[model samples]
Target chain A: MTDLSGKRILVVEDEFLVALEAASMLAEVGATVVGPAYHPAPALQFAKTEALDAAVLDINLGTGTSESIADTLKSRGIPFIFATGYGQLAGVDPDAVVIDKPYSQAQIVAALRHVLA
Target chain B: MAVVPQKDETRALLGLTDRLYRAQGLDDVYAAALDAIAVMLDCARASILLFDDQGAMGFVAWRNLSDEYRSQVSGHSPWQRGETQAEPIFVRDVRDTGEPDWLKAALAREGIVALGFVPLMANGVVVGKFMTYFGDPHDFSAHHRELAVAIARQVGFSLERHAAEKARSEAVRDLKESGDRFRLMSEDAPIMIWIADSQGKCLHLNRMLRNFWGVPDEVGDFDFTSTLHDDDRAAVGAAMAAALRDRQSVTVKGRYRRSDGAWRVLETTARPNFSASGAFMGMIGVNVDITEREEADAHKQLLINELNHRVKNTLAVVQSVARQTFRRDGTGDLEVEAFQGRLAALAQAHNLLAAEAWQSASLEEVARRSLNGDADVRIAIRGPRVELRPKQAVTTAMALHELYTNAVKHGALRSSEGRVELSWLTAEAPRGSLVVRWLERSPQPILPPVRRGFGSTMIEQALGADLNAEVEMDFQRSGLVCTIVAQLADTVRQ
Candidate 1:
């Protein structure tokens, strides 16, 4: 198994099953998973108030976009990667790593490692 | 009667010709003709009459004639309007001739007992006449008759010349008016318009085109092709050349440079123009700017890409649900793995189809994706270029995945010396059918499965129904062979 011990990662997804799967995958690798915020309000709150090592954000929430959350993470110097079902994201940081949907645990872990490194 | 010499008569005739030559208009000509009649015929009252628009002779100019007398004798003509070869009529006494009683009474009331009528000739046809009246009953002399005919000929020729001049001037005015109207319409048109000469040189460009090219009012030698973008210039030129050669109307599109150096797509339609005599003149064309429409089409394509992304994301969510449900049921690891493998195969097919905007997917690409990085020297794949529709593409991908997995786990790859060959070709037995064969050669024969599994069921039942195909799996003493035959028309793209 891939080791992510001592890592505090924020997981943000709107779908319940996808969020549960992502959190489980992160916990299995020994990382402390933060709030799997399903909405933009809580996601922004976590980005602003929580002490974090990194974050994985689904580019879109149920009602709104995760742009504000991504912006908050950026201001705090938190390493982050974007996950999206969209082929491309508009008005986001171009340099940010993007993981396409239906991604495996291996792909997410590899991207997270690269961002953290 | 006092005798008048021929010499005096000749002088009066020459003087009448000089006055007629100096006449300015129809009124002036009539005044001169009436004067000549009185002097030549030696009469106190005289008049000039001509054909009116209604083809009746009406008095145009006269002297010393009563209105009552003129009204009673109006429209009286011995010859028709177009009659040629007629002689003059002289009535020395109205009472002695076959004259209407009303006319003779009117003439008697005006104290006119005798009169002379000389027919006017214009272009070899009699148009009207000149009349001379004498108060006294008199004898008609040949010299007096000759003088009247000579004066009538001069006045007729002069009237015809005036009519011709009037017609020519009116035609010139009408031509100028219509030309002005055409210029006004073309200049104010919203789209670019141009007129070219027979040699394809642009002779005129409307105000819109002038502003588009940033040219001056006088275009002079400006070449329209110079404004065409470099990449599209040749194609537009060829199309225009062909249209001109064939004398056919043409519509062509190309990118053109605007005055501000921005490129815009313009659709131009041109047709050959001909003169009234059917001689080829040139071409007249209009250009419509379509840059905005082009941008809108590109935006639509971007939206399609975004929609495809959303569909793939939905599929991801379903995969997550399946994983969670399978884990809670204490499902066997093998079953979960198999389900995930099937989902991945479906997604792989979607990726290929989406890349081509969901039109079709390549068969070779489907096979390679199903191999999932295990495609090595031990396995050989050979086939002609083939394309599959969306439904068949997904089914074929999943079926290939099962076959590849089975061969690796149990059949060909299970032995070091094992090899597998997968090939497809069009079948001759059934028209428009394709056959795909999977032949595995193992050093030792493998035992066939005793019971049918999900893999076989999916390959045989689902794929066969979806594609209208025939599926056969034979486990021989030598090796395993699998063949699938499907109607190309239903499952494959030609």
Candidate 2:
């Protein structure tokens, strides 16, 4: 682990439990967890106001609208990783770290470290 | 019967015998002549056997026995040509006859024969054999027997008259059976068949008509118009009425109430039956039961519609999965198979869904699709009707298929000793939604995978998003427990 403590991490997940898990992971390393929003509008709004060190986005937002939030995060020079069921976001964000669905704690941490490095 | 011949009636030249011969046709001539000869001979039976050019003798009439015996004994009498006899040859005890095989066999089969073969000659030329049979063995009387020879002379005078009448009657009977042949074939056919006169009054009905309608045999005597169902009777009656009024043909498929009180579907074709005189008499038709075939056709159409819906949903899933999966690295047979495997899983799920007519599938069905294994599967589906949309059905099918494939690659189900127990339960959610748990359990030891693959992502994320459920899988040291909170309202389309 790269000791992502004190890092302000923005969580953008549609599922409450998954959001809890992401926030728990960031909190374990002493970082701040900003969001577990089901829809993209609140997530994008939260990203605009909050100082985000990084972001975790659930690829399937309500009404398939995750990219608008992804664009918002990119504008702020924040790094993000996509957690998705369908592997359908190739051309949209090829450079971002992608954590496939059903990720283990170790794999999620390792992938985030690579993205932040 | 004793005959008293009057001397005075005899004095009138046999009482207008000349006038009787002139007025009576030749058949009456043979009858009158044979009666007069019977009186002189005092024989019990006297018959005329006219010989044809083929030399076969035929009994034309009889005086002693009734017409019945005469017909039986003298049927196409077998007298050959060149067997000329100046005197009558008496056949006594003909039952013990010599075998030209047919002659002796025929006599033995009939059980009686006492023939008197009398050949009539004209100017030393043999014309035909005049034959008679006696009921008892009696010597021919000199005066009476001489009268039989004279009777034979009168037959020669009227042989042509007898032959022409016999041929005419035979031709009429042949034509009648020919007409009835068509009637017999259509009536006996398995399909319901019947005929009605131009008035639409049923005239003939075959056994099939009664059988298909479950009617008794006597139903043929009743009117067919009475048996039709109430809704169909009016239209069927109208078509029949139009056909009869126009003297044209009619074909109809209608419902009729059977004798068992069930309505049956019958397809009928009716055409005008005309007489030899060209008079339109009736119509004949056949009806067949098409109920089973119609039901099969309807089921097939529903399947086609269901298939179209599945295709559209599967394409959407593929479009999303392909774009995301290929984003990382879009090359190789491995990725393609992975993609195709997802689609195939979806297809297999659809197959099961289609089997159930798009109704809710058991968790076992989903599990069976998800895993590839040599293990026995036990399914426990406990819930109300949770009918899946085409999208839901496909996604579930594919997820299970991928799970099964992974299991086959590495799990308890991969070995012969293992079995998978797939169970589902619906629990009340906090927001009034429903939580459904799909748990795959086994007796063998297991461990969670070090790395989650594409299969895991599809099952955990895609299905979660679509179903609005949180899926948690804990790979226990003993087995696996996947707790899924599924909102019923999210899974089912409104």
Candidate 3:
């Protein structure tokens, strides 16, 4: 396993339990887990102010999409990946890595490595 | 003196022939006949009569006869209709013997003492008669009788020709009228209508079709395929060509550019046209605009996609909750992993169902996915193509997951040399019954567990209840063998 120690990763998800699960998974991988933001508002705020190595975003956040956070992360020259449950990717940057919902730990880790590389 | 009169009659007959030939109508022919009769027969008055539809004679053309005198003599016939080869009659004097006194009185009142009746022949049958009236008593010689017959022949031939011409012209007029009516109806129709020639060149386009293509209302061949969308052009052309080659009916759908620069989906149904004598004339087609219907279908597909996305997200949330509730410390890690594996198998089944819009899924796919680790090397899957309903597929997938994990932990898969074989097939005896077998073998003997666990319970109890299946799990020293048998209903077998 690749060590991500001291690397800060932000987890943004609408579902509380899902967000907490993703955060703990990142912490187990030796990375510093940032805000497990449950909505687009805090997710956007954290995206605008936080210094991050990478971001894992859920494309749909109940009220609206997390596209604004993705856009801010792009402007800040940060790499990110969109994890969605829609079966297919749509209306997003073509370069962004997309993973389906209920992703395994190995899939998430591999995707993080590819985006950060 | 006899030869001089005979020459005059011959000349008169020739002159009559010229006039009859140039006559424009039946009325002109009747006039010529009346004039020839008066001149050649040496009579001051003559009248032409023909048979009406009721078989009675009526005066059609006359000269120098009073209306009362003509009406009194009407219906006078010396020969019946359809009597062939009849000779003309000579009533040298109406005042002679063997005559009714009333007819004699009427003839005398009009100052007619002599009359000659000549029969007109058509198609070798008597059709009508012509009469000559003289003011004084006279005798008709053989020359006078022969002259009258010649004149009757000319008039008979002309009447027969006129009848034939009239029937022909009426048929032509009726045909033209029907054609005009068809054009009027086609132009006013709501759908686009077109007619093509045998060579596939469009010969006619109704008003709706012309407006659809923004073409002028002129009679010229138009290439209807020019306005078809690029992607649909080749396909539509090929279909039409095939239909034309075989002279068959065809239906094709494509996108066409309308006059307003918008694309509209159109479905055209066309049939081959034939003439009365069974000759291939061309094709006639009707086009219906279906853009609205196609758009509605696409919108429905989008809605189904959104719904599937929501369901997957809910499944993801459930997985997260299960993980949070189960402690991840060493003692509880195995339980958490087991729960997650079961959830993943269910999600995999859901994915398969969703791909097919939740209709059905194949058994081979469920087995391949559930037998996850070293499946290609250590396991053999053999089955005919079998399909199951949504509920049956989910249960079957869960059962396979349990069986696979159990073999890996405590069954045949725990030994390096162990192998597994799975097979399924349908039966005809029970009318669509299904049978599946799973056999595991290892060099080391396997033992039956003392206590049942969740995996065995799921495979044996839940699966059996959900599918109405009869399942048997046999633990032997050499391996473990599991068999399941179930009936497939017609509604769920796909």
Name the lDDT value of residue A23 in candidate 3. 84
Off by over 4 Å in 2: A1-117, B1-337, B353-385, B427-445, B490-494
lDDT of 3 by residue, A1-117 (tens): 445677899999988877887887788788898899888899999999998999999998898999889999999999889988765424567777987777766667888888888
User: Which of 1 and 3 is the better model by TM-score?
Assistant: 3
lDDT of 2: 0.62
Question: Could you tell me the TM-score of candidate 3?
Answer: 0.60
Q: Report the C-alpha lDDT of model 1 over B1-494, residue by residue, as the tens digit.
A: 65567887788778877877887888888888877777667777988888888899999889998887788889988888888887999988998988788877888899998888888888889888888888898877887777788888888888777777888789879877885677678998999999888887888889999999898988898888888888998888888888867879999999988899999899999998776787788888999998999899778766766776677678778878877898898988677667767776777777777677677888888888888765667778898888888888888899989987787777876876888888888755565587888888988878897777878977898779877889999997656799998886645655
Task: Report each candidate's C-alpha RMSD, comma-separated, in the order given.
Answer: 14.7, 21.3, 11.2
What DockQ do you compute for every candidate structure?
A: 0.31, 0.03, 0.39
Candidate 3 regions exceeding 4 Å error are A71-77, A88-96, B1-220, B234-253, B267-289, B328-331, B368-378, B415-418, B476-478
Q: List TM-score per model, in order.
A: 0.53, 0.29, 0.60
Interface Cα RMSD per model, in Å? 2.6, 12.4, 1.9
Per-residue alpha-carbon lDDT of candidate 3 for residues B111-145, written as tens digits (9 for 90 to 100): 98888888888878888888888887778877778
Q: Pick the candidate with the highest TM-score.
A: 3
| B129: Cα error in model 1, Å | 61
Better of 1 and 2 by DockQ: 1
- Evaluating just chain A, the predictions reach TM-scores of 0.92, 0.87, 0.93
